[model samples]
Target: MIVAAWTVCAGTVMPAAADTDPRGYLTKMKAQEMWKVADGTGITVAVIDSGVKDIPGLEGRVLPGMSFMEPPFERPDVSYPPHEDFVGHGTTMTAGIVGDGSAGGPRGLAPGAKVLPIRTSVGTPMAFAVASEAAKGIRYAADNGAKVINLSIGMTQDWPMGKIKPAVEYAQSKGVLIFAAMGNEGEGNNWTNVIAALPGVLGVGAVDEDGQVMPFSSHGPDTDLSAPGGQVLNRCNGNKDWCVGDGGTSYATSLASASAALVWSAHPDWTANQVARVLIQTAGGPVDGAKRSDWVGYGAVRPRKVLLDHEGDPGVPDADPLASPAPAKAPTPSAEQTAAAPRRVESADAESGLSWQWPALGAVVALSLGITVLVKRRRR
Candidate 1:
């Protein structure tokens, strides 16, 4: 039941060129132009992670949310502002979705979207005891009007998929889009965590400014999309200044969620499946033919292509994008089966592990400065 936040930090400060726009991923993804069409005006994205802080960049955008952390660790109520970010991970994820960039602060992909923060213990000593909280959080978000649910955390221990399937099904049934991070374990085998492997979730991977899949980004069959995650900038804990060296599939998950918001806001009538289809079809990859790869899934998310050019066919609005014929009954994995799976390393910094070399592809590189990568450690 132990869960870990999937984020990494770069030890160095942001490069001088990144100062022009701390959130350079927006420009690279053509988000600025898309904003003219749709700025996620009426959407609400649920950030289910550690917790979201009410910073100036996020300001009034953060709504009251519930915390499953318990006792003195828990907040007042669901109406209470979730301003307790123990590791700054949730705040960074929130900034990726809703930062207004006012006063030269970090700008989000969906600056106009509202955030519903649901705090869970994704990276704490008590994480193992609160696994069911994630499932409850998803159901709560869907019932309370969350259009998109972003889970920037993953379980480090092997838990029964059944524990979360019902909640995931409930969210999908309510027309909510869910995105989870493909863990930052590279090819280390811990990347395809249970949440990422689920049928109804869109598993996201990380790519650098160059659009190259980061060496540390997880790769597996479950990865549904890729986004700018390497060396991305976000707010630091208890500080409004941008933390320039943070990167991981966690950031990519937030960006992908925001991209969904932009598309949904623009086409209010489109179903979650249709929005997902558009993202998959319009994604920019190494080659048009190689749209789905183990490394980057359906390729780098290009919301602008979907928003500006009105590209791609959003096939079957009501169809589930990740649906397979429902098994007679979903088979639950045995404890032994779960244990056999590669468990994530438990560490304070989840992405600071040994680097795996990935094949380099020639692509246009964008210069965006900001964070160091921290690797997560395994629980004993």
Candidate 2:
């Protein structure tokens, strides 16, 4: 039985037992569901958060990533890079999304997937840094070959999602599926968070094992899907030995990313929209018509539906998901806007040609070694 009055996000799961740890749960779940075909074997997930460390369990699994904070904290997990997970929040997100247990840690929903760890935010104390730096990291991740993006951070800016929006747009054009977390103020429903509100983002919500929406989880038209959240479970404070009580839409977003990986891995040719639509269309419901509810969006995502039904049609590759034809007259970027952007920030997908593969990324991760890397001065 779940705890009442406790509100958490959906897609969150309980930690594993002593012998059957998170890694074991992942293995069992994958085996039980025959998810190896969609275990995200060769895909790359860009985890945008406080950044990810290449833990021993995930050795040779990580590629180079950029940071937005100021110096002393801008690099990826180098020898001296930020070793002690500053908040320890990002690591939890990483493990939940892509952990393929080699150690005693928990296995991720898409254990076979590789992760691109990028830092975009610090906390409420550094909102500005988070916003600006997240924008930079967004562009940097897209510039490389991140086919799927997972961002658990929220923004305070109210301006139309700005730089991150453009980067997401370009990524979509290049066939990347992006997932973001809705704000964690659903009880009050504040309107400041932009991470989940941006168009083209798979904004996720938090639900429990019983599928009740967490009171603290944010709700809006933006939250298109729900995942395990309230009174949730995962590596407690990065200690796989004891799972911690979890909440918030951040973790749910990561799971949504993992789900995208599963779908994408199954149908590599589908456009990002088709992958997203399959998840939404096949989601578990208390749903009614075409319109979705504000609390749970289309409904709780049951990836098992896709794993079983298996009749998804993602439309043509050239067809834009949002637009009918991607109007030719769409506003082009200004000199300043384009100048501030990093090289390949808009996705040179055709040029990059980095097709994701579990064991094959060794060469791409090497080639992407010296590519665009932006380290922010602060955590913002």
Candidate 3:
């Protein structure tokens, strides 16, 4: 069944983000053994979830973010006050990717990384009427200075690649890293689609502490890596100091994004694809990519190898992360892919100038993999 989509125009009446604890996301990610390399100091992670408040660990650190939710009619709906995290899900996800806050309990993989919250909803369907909303979020994140984007939710429908695909492509063009949950319905119905399966996205799956794939972790062809996403501790409501644990691909995706942050922060000169390649090449604890299972994709994420050993080459700097989606063929419900439709591209108010975030060594031509080198120069 398809859900009705709503519009969230800028002056609409929207609720504020919940102010409760949100540590569940981080602690679990760290416990999975992926934090050893995540320092994320120079990276900015865009968290598209319920809403993120200025909690203790995330205050002063989070920049102004946009709330794509619609409000009643008048009154400011800044996504901060009224909609506070009645459900601490978004905060937990955000914390997982980049939390340094003390009060929550668990710390993020990249303590120094910052977050740009895109207050979208997992509960209600909005302006996604045509799928432009997802694109809007992707573009907004890229244009604003977010080096990585994390989408932790999923829809129950299977729409073709129209607006959503391009939005992901555009973000990649601007050098943004996109990560989405593989889904938590592993043992259940296990239906998957959209943002998570898109060409440029990094589809993250969930695994347990035993390095075994969680029964509920969905097994789609899009899953790129398995990360700790089982029962783990995190922040939630009440007392604001208490912590709890839950498991889902959302947590796995968050940690994957943080892992990327650590590698990028360390090698600021590398492009998003280079960082991604380095990661896939060094991913941990042997599982067969050849005999791949429905549970674990590639393998459980082992980020320490990337930071400490740097075993593989960064490949071409301009290579597309999804350039070879051919390798990760996820099984679709229908043999036929939904019709591919082109869509709109929205510009964001955020700008990085690409300078403050990282230095440009002036290569005019970035390194390209699988091809002979051709020299090009932009004289300063």
Candidate 4:
């Protein structure tokens, strides 16, 4: 089957050349320091992606979750048990959130939390057809004791929102905080995933180890936050080996969701709004001094600022700090705008004077069998 435009947002994965340590993202974000304050205990993060496997580091931490990859959503040629990963995207994402580093696997930012894995047809040809399944996943997550939902998936082209809107609203009403990837369409396409643009969902972008936004991270007003995504270490597809992701907003969303888990675990009584408010308030805002920017939203997520420094006033618990007026239709970028976009970005505000750029990267993996490169359309 062909890969769909809407795929897992883990980006291009390749066998690790070096840097096998999974602590890169944790060290870059300075998450270890915050772990002392909150390791996401008592929080269940729902991972809605290409399913999750009970891997080495995630043993005993994964709760049983339903799979939507049946009949209409599943390709006739492929079949797998519920919660079994096909592309390993969900497993990697789960590792990012709660992996405990057992058996020498990737370590998560929130080692004390549990994961609820929701399987869907992400990274498959049926991704677009299964768009409604994402909504169903959201509803299922909200009803199943999930406090935070992570959507490391998105479609390159806009999809119908009839099912997604209400599902997101339903999850939000249940006090669930949703985080989604801002697809890898990059700046030229400037496409924002419909799911990420929802009223309560926080759309996340990606930043590299150098603290600069990667070229492939999408840009737009809906971009709510940023996190580490470049060259992240992840588990290989359906295997025990480790692979390095070239960078995608998917990892960023996972880290951001984990950040919320840490904050929420520390302040269990705080509502979702209060957690979000603190995250945005403590984030490193744009260097240009703007309150919010399309490139990086409120700024790069810095949960440490809240957990370590005891920063951020958890103002009114019910107030929506990230809410904005209905988003206007985006305008097409002119020749000059496209030509001026930069390859690497250090600022998220519009006035930063950096242009946008898009560069596609491919994934190559060397499994026990052999080496193979995969080029597929996938999640945001």
Tens-digit per-residue lDDT, 1-380, candidate 3: 11111111222112223243333333433433444544777799988766675577666557677766544345445343312443455677776666664663457777778888876533432323324445677788999999999877554344424666677778888889888776655443564434566665777777655455555566666766667765544444331433544436777788788888888887899998888776665554333324234455555555566666555467778765445443222221111111111111123412311110111111112223321211111111
Error of 1 at 90 (Å): 0.7
How high a TM-score does candidate 4 get? 0.80
20-108 in candidate 1: lDDT tens per residue?
Answer: 34466777777779999999989999998878866677888888987766433354343323577766678888888998876445688
At residue 260, candidate 1 shows an lDDT of: 96
**How well does candidate 1 match the true structure in TM-score terms?**
0.79
lDDT of 2 by residue, 1-380 (tens): 00011222222334444332223323323334747457877788887666665565566666677666544344545432422345546666777776665555545777777888776435323334555566776677778888898877664344425566677777766677777776565544233245556556767876654455655566665667777653434444433333534546776677778888887887777777777767765555442333355666665665655775664445655543333332222222211111111122124542353211111100111222322212111100
Worst 10 residues of 1 by lDDT: 332-341
Q: In model 2, where do residues sit more than 4 Å from their true spots?
A: 1-31, 72-84, 101-104, 124-127, 234-242, 287-291, 318-380
Weakest lDDT window of 10 consecutive positions for candidate 3: 354-363
Candidate 1 at 344: error in angstroms? Answer: 20
| lDDT at residue 205 of model 2 (Cα atoms) | 73
Give the total clashing residue pairs for model 3: 24
Q: TM-scores, in order shown? A: 0.79, 0.71, 0.70, 0.80
Local error of candidate 3 at residue 125 (angstroms): 7.7
**Candidate 4, position 147, lDDT:** 96
Each model's number of backbone clashes? 30, 31, 24, 8
**What ranges in model 4 sit over 4 Å off?**
1-14, 20-22, 72-80, 237-240, 324-380
